[model samples]
Target: MSLTHDATLRELPTEHGVLRYHEAGDPGAPPLLLLHGSGPGVTGWRNFGANLPLFAEHFRCLVLEFPGFGVSDPTDQHPMVAALPAVGRFLDALGLEQVDVIGNSMGGVVSTRFALAQPDRIRRMVTVGGMGRAIFSPSPGEGLNLLMEFTEAPSRERLIEWLNSMVFDRALVTEQMIEERWAQATEPSTLAAARRMYSRAALEGMAKAASTSPEPPYWAMLHQVRARTLITWGRDDRVSPLDMALVPMRTIPDAELHVLPNCGHWAMIEQKSAWEAAVLAFLTRKD
Candidate 1:
């Protein structure tokens, strides 16, 4: 039988508000906190939807809903850095001293920041297509504009086309995926929340942080992280290309990297078997 839905729904009262989380598998198993990317329809489940059942069998997986995403309460602040405190609060509320942290894209940036600020709280780190230095072909804002246009477009096909632009494989853009994303993106609060999040200053601030943070960019930080690390990427990812991950593989002494060929940005969804195998192998390593 599948795990009970209630078994996965959990909440933690933080200083900001009550954050919603989904926990699966044995409560006493080792802990893993999963963080999702930032996008028009991002949520923890959307990021790891395909890997949940597999991860549940081995680890106590907690999928976090970031502020303004999913069912979580919106924060007064705009930038993600402002929300790091809440992550710390969630960890404290759960009475967890340390946890394995896994994140993608924007969430990866937040995870890296949290680890840097509170290194003692992180046990192991795994980042898939995680953030790093700025890589702009046109402009960073162009990506946001494309998503916004397609998300607000009246025609469903156009929306799917725009969504598919982020991935290498068009077949992965199923109707169910588009409908699910549209439902979340068109929620009453999403526009207002996104407006706050992408104000010119907020975007500029994020750009600056990406370009000039004193701490090692994600790659540099990978070297300093005391915990064992695993890095995975989709070979055909359009958003954060695997071409950029090469330097990090050499820098991190204890890190292992896996690339899923023919997969797109959503490795968890497109090539789940390989992704799960890599993740489980890393987590179970006795070294």
Candidate 2:
């Protein structure tokens, strides 16, 4: 069967819940796990669907829908907290001992955390923004603020504002895109989960807790990532901002950085060909 979005739709029951994913490419090919961001209406398909055909040509592409995103089963734990275990379970379910990864925003953070925790499971990784701290730029940058705003109150206007911030070229935010996102973003279960992650109260609570937590933040531990990593960013990313990539680029022992100009938070989608070229080269490189 040919690979297409609907044709690739699949689900696997895991200890966490029913894990929904899109699978393409030969089952015999090396697996490539694609993880999506934490935007209000985000899903695995929405984030990486367009890139699947190209990636599937070389590797088995599995776009995982993280828990609490409406596409996957809902969980009481924060989505980020639920994500790590979901990844492990999904891989275990598929009998994939190790695989390459491509993560966007929140997914990047999750992938980094997973690599640190299970050093042997990730052969290589690529992250499109959201892997580090804001050394110079303001915390919770423009795109995040808009995201929180939309999560706090669901409105077509707010969703539009957030979508516009995702790409450097506003033209990418089409009416159909807005409508699809709006429908999903407003779903009662999805919106509630989003609040747990992006509401002002949640952000404040997390900050206050992090202030007293004994553990150092993940960015401080980037030096420990064992996998070869490609840290891709958009020069115009308003969400995480370009400065955030500095720490990961400089710290990850086996890492390289690529920043595409005239792009924003969604580098993989906004600068599709260039991002794919960079990622494919890194993943397939032998040195």
Candidate 3:
């Protein structure tokens, strides 16, 4: 069923399990994968809504729902690093050798891991507000849980407050967006999975994933990647701040950085035009 445009929801099998994804634009065109952030109601649809169709205009775009989010699955069992191989598996399943990857937040972290682990599988990389260092970023699962509680029990005021903490502009937190997010949060298994993700063990796993796998002093594997990369940051992002992730952008041999003003964590959403243009230019650049 076509919702807001003709983006079709589809599913594909991976080594671990099934993955639900959205595909739009032309299938025969160059492939570009869109990865969503880690937030309540944070499907690829929500994160890339403004940019996906536009990307599809010139290239094939696939937006994937990570296992624990959206209609994919209901468990926090897969850490960001563990999911790296799954991206390869996904490419295999789709018969794709390599493709440009555009990811945000957690997906960006996973994308980095995938590119590092299997460089040949990635044609290029673009990360928006990506995590490249371990910092005291608040747990999105915890935030999602609080939103869930407020939703199931009817706490509109509380939900609004929680949203304010996410976006730099409180005015952008529309009542419609809040209600949609509330619906997703209040779903039975979604909250449980989010709770599981918020546990101490999971938090530690996330830290380890961030430090050892994606970015950091343990960036030994990153030097192997040959794909040209683009790092875009919302200057005002509290989660995965630009300053913390600068090392990856600077250190990676084939990387460039762009810091967007008047934007927050969700740069692709908040600065759609600039974000899309930067990404397209990066992907199509002749080097």
Candidate 4:
């Protein structure tokens, strides 16, 4: 079946809320969950809409909309915090025992955490940026600053700034893209959630809390992941710099790294063919 927006859209009621997702390909095919980033106005459809048809040809593509994002029900918890459980519940509702996952930015972080917490559930994992902490570059890089700035004050100019930071080529940030992002991003609840996640005050509080917390950061636990991971990054990623892939590359037992040149945070979008070729080979490889 052709993977169109309306044809693939689906929803499931879970205890947390009604979880929305886009599904394509044969139900009997191996499940491939595509988790989206935490950027303002981000949604599963927006993130993977272009690649869904391609991926659906090989595997059942499930593009899940994490809660606290405008596409799904709002939750009191931060979107990042809420995503892990939402993933588990979504899979449970679908009766999926194991699935391959492709995560972008914030989704990558959540996927790593999920793999650590429930090692057997994920078959193979692929992450596009936003996995590990910065080893060399400053934390919360330029793209993040722009993201926070826009979250703190929703303006078209700020949104465009943040969008520009997402890609190495600014031409990708078209008028329609900006308009769609602006409409969803400025929605009262969505904007409030963005503030909770990316506002200056929220960021500062998180840093302070983490500094005092005894719990080790997620990157430290990468060794425990049973899934073979493919960590993909854009050479010019401004949000989570290319250097952030270091820890995971060195740590995850059976991990491979793929760096796409002339790309930024949105590697999958900015370098679509290269990203897809590498990821498809990894996911389909018998070895």
Best model number under lDDT? 2
Per-residue CA lDDT of candidate 3, range 10-66, in tens? 888665778878888778999998877765566778887667667878888888777
Which model, 2 or 4, shows the larger lDDT?
2
Better of 1 and 2 by TM-score: 2
lDDT of 2 by residue, 27-120 (tens): 9999999999998678889899999889999999999999999999998998889999999999999999999999999999999999999999
Local distance difference test scores for all models: 0.72, 0.93, 0.71, 0.92
Count of backbone collisions within predicted model 1: 0
TM-score of each: 0.85, 0.99, 0.83, 0.99
Candidate 4, residues 136-205, lDDT tens digits: the string is: 9998899999998999878999999999999999999999999999999999888888888999999999
lDDT of 3 at 189: 70
Cα lDDT over the full model 1? 0.72
Clashing pairs in 4: none
For model 3, what is the alpha-carbon lDDT of residue 209?
A: 72
Clashing pairs for model 3 are none
Residue clash pairs of candidate 1 = none
